[model samples]
Every structure is written in structure tokens, then in C-alpha cells.
Target: MKMNHGFSWQYDEFKQVGTDYGSKAEVEIYDSSHADFRDMEAESIRILDSLEIKRSNVLIDFGSGTGTFAIQAARRCARVYAVDVSRAMIDRAEAKAIKAGTSNIEFHHAGFLTYEHNDSPVDAVVTTFAFHHLPDFWKGIALKRVNSMLKPGGQLYIHDVILEETNAVENIAALIDKLATAGGKLLREDTERHFRDEYSTYDWVMDGLLSRSGFTIKSKHIEGGVLGTYICTKN
Candidate 1:
């Protein structure tokens, strides 16, 4: 699909705030820093299992980060597309793929709103901790593009920080305090910056966006009143 030239209100996802992941040094430290809280490998396997991915299936992981999930997915699927907005992240993920001897994974330096898939429609799309980069409207557009890239009944798994509307202020405050206790002052500051600067929206908003973008929510889980995981299928 061709992007519209006349559209002028698009968001630039590459221009990051709170953290600059474009630097090689930052990319190098990403895994270690996130490892304290995220067991990404286990999470990847869980997603694959949930999707019932077959050896013949093709998968695309948006915001592939350091390629941990992409490398693992490549081992189980026919092909894996690892897409990220940062060139540094793409380079690091490619190196990790090489080290792991996984050759079926293709790396692309792009984000949710910009990445275009020209090959056959994929079987599944997986994105974790990344969708909040876009504001709500662009997120809807991104979801439409993702839907276009998938065959009918294709699965999409999204894991990110999504807030609940009920007592949202208290929930966010409690989450920040909990994170601070678990990971120290750095995590505290990061959580503060995330709320202050990021685009994570309420659960109701996300539900509306997903439904409007032609996805049927098969399952949804919310953890710690903050993190939300939605397993959806293209309708």
C-alpha cells in the first residue's frame, strides 16, 4: 500500500524522548537493563504457543528491539521479519541473529507507521512494549497497515503499558511506586518519564481502536493495573 502524500499530520516516531536508543552504546545496554524486569525469551515462546505457530508460518515482529524474540521465532517459523525504528537496534539485532546462526530472520529499520511488508501476507504479527511510541490516531493507522499485511484470521499480539480508567490516578501512582521498589531510582525516574512523555492510552481507547481497525479481541489480560496484553485476530 502506498502512503498518502497529502497527509501532513504524521508523527515522527524516530524522534525519541526520555531515552535515546539511536546510539550504539544505548543499544548495547538495552537487553541488560530490560532483563531485570522482562524475561523476553519466555514471553516470546508464550506468544508463539498462543498463536500455534507452525513451521510453515511467517511472522513479523514490530519493534523487534535486540532481536531476542525474532531469533527465537525464526527457529520455529519459516521466516521472521524484525522491524525497528532505530538503525542501532537493527544492527545489534542482526549481529545477534548471526551469532545465533539464525538466517531466516530479515531485519528492517522501520517503525509501526512506516514499515511496509511487500512479501506474502504473514501468519502472525507480534509487538511488545513498543506500540506506545505512536499517539492514538497514528496507532489506529498503524493497526490498519498491520491488518493489510496479514492474511485473513492472522493473529496480532500486543503487549504494552495500557492504563485502566477506573481510579487511573491511583493505579498509575501505585505502579510507579511498585516499579521504583523493584528496580530502584532509575526505574522510578523512567516510569515518571514514561507517564510524563509517552502516549500510552486507556484500555477503553485501545479496545475501540482495535475493533475499529478490524481486529477481534480473542483474549485480553491486564497485569499490575498497567501492563496489558491483547491477543487479536484480523476479522
Candidate 2:
């Protein structure tokens, strides 16, 4: 699909905010920082298992940071597209994939609103902690684009920080405190930056966005009243 250049309200996702993942230093520290809260390798395995990935399947991973999921998925799927907005991230992921001897993965320096999937419709698309980079409207547009990239009944898995409406203030505070305890000052500061600068939205809004984007929400799981995982199928 051609990019819209005319007058529109779409947000430019490439604009850096608090943390610039494009920086080599940031990319280098990403895995270590996230390791405080995430077991990325195990997470990749779980996502692949959830999707029931096969040797013949083609998968696309949006914002595939440091090649964790993309490299792992490449082992099981026929081809894997690792798309991210950061050139540094793409470079790092590519290096990691090479070190692992996984060559079926193609790396793209692109974002959700900009990446074009020109290949055949994929079997599944996965994005973790990345979709929130876009505003709600752009997220809908991105989801529509994702829907167009999938085969019939294809799956889209999104894991991100989505807020719950009930006691939002309390929940967010508790989550911040918990993260601080688990990951120390850096994570606490990161979480604060996310809330202060990022665009994570509410569950109700996300539900509507997914439905309007021609997706059937198969399951929704929210952990610690903040982290949301939505398993959806293209309608």
C-alpha cells in the first residue's frame, strides 16, 4: 500500500520521544534493561506455541527488537519478517540472527504505520510492547494495515501496556511501585517515562479498534492490571 502523503491526521511514528531506540547505545542496553521484567526467549517460545507456528508458515513481527522473536520464529517458520523503526535495532537483530545461524529472517527498518508487507499474506503477525508507540487513531490505521497483510483467519498477537479504567490511578501507582522493586530505579524511571510520554490507551478503546479493523478478539489477558495481551484473528 502506498503511503498517504496528502492531508491527514496520521501521526509520524518515527519522531523520537523519551528514549531513542535508534541510538546504538540504547539498542545495546535494551535487552539488559528489559531482562529485569521479561524473559524474551521464553516469551518468544510461548508466542510461537500459542500461534501453533509450522515450517510452512510465514510470520511478520512488528517492532521486533533485538531479534528475539524474529530469530526464534525463523527457526520454525518458512520466512520471518522483522520490522522495526530503528535502524540500530534492525542492525543488532540482524547480527543476532546471523550469530544464531538463522538466515530465513528479513529485517526491515520500518514502523507500524509505514511498513508495507509486499509478500503473500502471512499466517501470523506479532508485536510486543510496540503498538503503543502510535496514537489511538494511528493504531486503528495500523491494525487495518495488519488485517490486509494477513491471510483469511490469520492471527495477530499484540502485547503492550494497556490501562484498565477501574482505579486507574491506583493501579498505575501500584504497577510503578512494583516495577521499581523488581527492576530498581531504571525500570521505575522507564515506566514513568512511558506514562509521561507514550500513548498507551484503555482496554475499551482497544477492543473497539480491533473489532473495527476486521479482527475477531479470540482472547484478552491483562496482567497486573496494566500489561495486556490480545490474541486476535483476521475476520
Compared with the true structure, what per-residue lDDT tens digits does model 1 show for residues 1-235? 5454456766777887656678898888788777767788898898899999999999999989899999999999999999999999999999999999999998988888888798999999999988988899889989999999999999999999998888888889998898788778877888898889889999999999999999999999888778999999999
Q: Rate the local accuracy (lDDT) of all candidates.
A: 0.89, 0.91
Clashes per candidate, residues 3 or more apart or on different chains = 0, 0
Off by over 4 Å in 2: 8-10
- Weakest 10 consecutive residues, lDDT, candidate 2? 1-10
* Structure candidate 2, residue pairs in collision: none
TM-score of each: 0.96, 0.97
